[model samples]
Target: MRQQIVEAREKAAKDGIRVQRARTPAPDVAAPVGEVTEATEPFQDNGTLRTISARYDLTGQRELLWIANEGKKVGDARCTQKFQFSNNTTPRERPTMLLCWRTSQDKSVVVLAVTPEGRPDTRDAVAKLDTRWSAMG
Candidate 1:
């Protein structure tokens, strides 16, 4: 995942796209949880814009909060709860779906698939990752 992040940044730079990463501070809780390992990156492949991210919480107690906090960033109304995947979209005119899921007790992943206005949907890529992770556990 770290390698992927580095590659994504390099690709983004090569394509003349500036990647701005937003770091969300963990919520204020009574007790401090263990350290979290996280990585996120956005890049373009075959004309499709994709963002992949993962978070691993040692305590396995903040997965839900992390997901909800991410949803809030996009927009509460656009987010919908599913069995495992929490699906949402950006608030732009042509929204890009953000597919996220908790893959294990302490790990969660999020993916975004974007294409040109008239291009075919690339969301399947995101779904594939979800399926693969779910199967591993």
Candidate 2:
């Protein structure tokens, strides 16, 4: 656990990502499980990373959906997960922390699912990130 945190911090530094901790409490709608580490950086895609912290229960389902929406908003690519949320269903929360960026050269969106301890799950992070790349098309 400690190793993961250290690694993530090191990667962030190497990538030149400056982690930005929130100064104030986020709204209930934006953050229900309590906000975790929120960080963003300018990268290759010309898209700024927007990571919304979630909790342990989060499966990143909604975050994927949100990313799709963002792609649509930015006039780039749209997310492929097309299931619409019903009014009665409360979407699952996202990971406590999300690390997002683009390939330094290709500008592909990279999404990493972070662990509760605030460390990114490096093993599967890039794979999960690849799933969202389809939306880039």
Candidate 3:
């Protein structure tokens, strides 16, 4: 438990990830049985390093904007990204979270999803981001 933190910190430094204050989600021993076990960050591709904080347990297409906003809210981390996963047979195509920063500009976001069956679907996540960014302004 504690060792994971130390190891992650070391890896982050190597990846240029500065965890101002890294906090690992404590095990939810009381959580309902079979509920994704405890801890968040699984949704971030399980990279040993932490370039950014991620949440998936309660995270969804809805929170995409929130996370992106947090990134944009800070400094010029303007170029932000997020990934969402779904295990359903029918997946939604509605672009989510600050999708396109500027259509005129070449910058765009890419959304990738993986199913419980190990299938992959990647698309533009910036289309919705553009909408959310507009609303924020």
Top-scoring candidate (lDDT): 1
Per-candidate Cα lDDT values, in order, are 0.41, 0.40, 0.30
List, residue by residue over 15-80, the lDDT tens digit for candidate 1: 998775432344653434444444443434343433333444322233333233333323111221
Q: What is the alpha-carbon RMSD of candidate 2 to the true structure?
A: 16.3
Residue 44 error for model 2, in Å?
A: 0.8
RMSD of each: 10.7, 16.3, 16.0
Clash pairs, model 3 backbone: 97-129, 98-129, 98-130, 99-126, 99-127, 99-128, 99-129, 99-130, 100-126, 100-127
Winning model by TM-score = 1
Better of 1 and 2 by TM-score: 1
TM-score of 3: 0.19
- Model 1 regions lying over 4 Å from their true place: 1-23, 26-94, 118-123
TM-score of every prediction relative to native: 0.35, 0.25, 0.19
Error of 3 at 117 (Å): 25
Better of 1 and 3 by lDDT: 1
Q: For model 3, what is the error of residue 89's alpha carbon versus the real structure, in angstroms, after optimal superposition?
A: 41
Runs with alpha carbons beyond 4 Å of true place in candidate 2: 1-32, 52-55, 60-137
2 or 3, which is superior by TM-score?
2
